[model samples]
Target: MTIADKGPRTRPFEANWLARIGWLLLALYVVYAGAQLGFSWQRFSDGLGQGGKFIARMFPPNFTRWELLMSGIVESLQIAVLSTVVGIVISLPVGLLAARNLMPAWVTWPARGFIALCRSFHPIIVAILFVKAVGFGALAGILALIIASIGFISKLFAEAIEEISLKQVEAVRATGAGFTHILIMGVQPQVLPRFIGFAAYQLDSNLRNSTMVGIVGGGGIGATLFTAYQRFDYDFVLAMLIVIVAMIMVAEIVTGWARKVFQ
Candidate 1:
C-alpha cells in the first residue's frame, strides 16, 4: 500500500486531560488546606526536634515493676485469645446467614445491618462504651475485641461465601441433600481456607487492640502504659512499648504458622 494510504499512526501513550486536571485540583486543594490548618515546614522541623528529645528520655527502661508488667501482658493475651475464639464461633453462623446467595433477604438484611453496626465505630470507642457498661476490667476488653472481631470476620466470611461456586451447591442439592449437608459438602470446602486466614488476621488485630483497650479502663498493658506516661515515667513506658512490640511479633509468627497449617 502507498504510505499515504496508511491510517494515521497512534501514539503508544496518550495524555488523559481529565485525570491530569483532577490531580492538579487535588494538589491545589491540599495546599489550600495546609495553609488553613497552619501546617508549615518550620513547625514540623521544631516538632521533630522535640520528639527526638522525648524519645531520648525513654532509654534505660525500668524493669523494677516486672510483676505489674507481667500481669498486664497476661491479661491482654487472655483478652485476645478469648475474643478471637468467641468471635470465630459466632461469625460462622452470622456469616452464613448474611450470605446473599445462601439466605433470603429477610435473613441477610438483618445480619448485614448487625455487621454494619458493629463496624460503625472504632474498637477504642467500643471499648470505652463497654467499660462504662461492664464496669471495666478484662471483661470489658474481651467484649470490645469480640465486637471488633465479629464485624471484620463476619463481613469477610459473608463475602467469601457469596463468591463460592453455585454449581457445587446445586450438585449437592440435586443429591437430595439438606441445607446442612450441602453446606458441609459444597460450601465449606470452597470458603473454609479463606475463613481460616481471616480468623488468623482477626487474632493478630485483636492482640494489638487488647493493649489499647486497657487505656480506656478495659484492662491491659495500655492502662499501665498510660499510667507511666501520666507519671512521667518514660523509662517504664519504653519497657511496656518494647514488651508490646515483642508480643505482637510473636503473635504474628504464630498466626502465620497457623494459616500455613490450615491452608
Candidate 2:
C-alpha cells in the first residue's frame, strides 16, 4: 500500500502550448496593426475633443421639418417590410433546395452558389449599384435589401433544415410519402419555428439597412440624414438618430414577441 502500489496519477489539466503560442502571435499582430493604423493615446484624446464639439452642436434636436422626417420614416418602413416579405418568400424554396440532406448535389450546389453570390457584396455596395442602375429611388433600396435578406435568411434556413431529425423524415418516407409530402409533414414542422425566428431577425436587419441604403440614393431616411450632414444640420441628424434608435427598439420587441408565440 506504498506510493508505488498506486497507479500513475492523471494530470487534472494540461497546458496547450500550441494554442498559447498562437494567441501570443495574434496579440503581437494586433499591436503591430494598431501602430500601422496610427492608433495612439494622443490621437484618441484629440478625437475626443473634436467629438465633444460635434456633440455640442447636436443639442436640441430639430424636428421643425416634421413633414420631411415623417416622409423619410414612412419610406424606410415600407422598404423594410416589402424586402422582408419578398425575401422570405423566395428563401423558402432556395433554402430547401440548398439543404444537402434534402436535395440532390446538383440542386444543392447551384442553390448554395446562388446564396454565396448574394452574400458576396455588402448591402451598401449592392444599394449603390442598384441606385446607379435604377437612378435613385425606393425601388433600388428595396431590391438591395431583398438581396441581403435572401443571402442571410436562406443560408440560415438551409443550415436549420440540415440539422433536423432524420427519424421523422424516415417515418414519413416509410408511409409511402413522396418528396413534397415528406417535406410538408416531416421537414416543415421541424424547421418552421426556426424559420419564423430567422424571418423576424431579417426584418430587423432590413429595417436598419433600409435607413442606410438611402445614403447611396436608394431613397429613405439616410438621404435626408445625408442632406442634413451636408448642410451642417447636426440637430436634424440627432433627431433622425433618435427616431432610428426608437424604430430599432420597437422592432426588437416585436420580433422577440413573435419568437415566443411561434415557439
Candidate that would win on TM-score: 1
Q: What is the model-wide C-alpha lDDT for candidate 1? A: 0.94
- Listed in order, each prediction's TM-score against the native is 0.93, 0.91
What TM-score quantifies how close candidate 1 is to the native fold? 0.93
Window of ten residues with lowest summed lDDT in model 1? 3-12
Instruction: Identify the runs in model 2 with alpha carbons over 4 angstroms from their true place.
Output: 1-20
Tens-place lDDT digits, model 1, residues 1-263: 99767889777799899999999999999999999999999999999999998889888898999899999999999999999999999989999999999999999999999999999999999999999999979999999999999999999999999999999999999999999999999999999889989999999999999999988999989899899999989999999889999999999999899899888
- Residues 50-89, candidate 2, lDDT per residue (tens digit)? 9999999999899999899989999999999999999999
The reply for model 1, stretches above 4 Å from the true place, is: 1-11
Residue 134 of model 2 has an lDDT of 89
Root-mean-square deviation of Cα positions for candidate 2 versus the true structure, in angstroms: 2.5
> Which clashing pairs does model 2 show?
none
